[model samples]
Target: MTSSQVFLSIALPFAIIPLVLFTSSKKIMGEFKIKTWVKWLAWIATVILVALNIYLILQTVGILK
Candidate 1:
């Protein structure tokens, strides 16, 4: 795969997962924790990214046409 695709399909999910987790953690952010709406948005975005990554893996493995 191309470098950009590798970054988008792999590295981005890894980076965003931690960001979502950290931002949503009460212990991590204390009083500055992300708002409910923002947290939901981040979670939704993370889910989408994860789903896309799964699709990419399936395609690479020839499970997807």
Candidate 2:
């Protein structure tokens, strides 16, 4: 259970972070680039997810209890 949690928290963010970054990049996405508001929202969501993942890892390590 713990191993699964670690794997999911770590892997999920890696996948999502890149998606947000790439989509927000004008050079990479060209005419398909995301709007400023959407980019900000995506970044905010990404940061929250990452922070939650970090908290989860700390909890799993007995550092947050």
lDDT of each: 0.85, 0.91
Model 2 whole-model lDDT (C-alpha atoms): 0.91
Clashing pairs in 2: none
Worst 10 residues of 2 by lDDT: 1-10
Q: Write the per-residue lDDT of candidate 1 for residues 1-64, one digit (tens) a residue.
A: 6658755787777789899899889999999999999999999988987998988877876799
lDDT, residue 31, candidate 1: 94
Candidate 1 versus truth, CA RMSD in Å, comes to 2.0
Q: What is the lDDT of residue 6 in candidate 2?
A: 94
What would the TM-scores of all predictions be? 0.75, 0.87
Considering every candidate listed, which one attains the maximal TM-score?
Answer: 2
Model 1 reaches what TM-score against the true structure? Answer: 0.75
Model 1: worst 10 consecutive residues (lDDT sum): 1-10
For model 2, what is the error of residue 47's alpha carbon versus the real structure, in angstroms, after optimal superposition? 0.7
The top-ranked prediction according to lDDT is 2
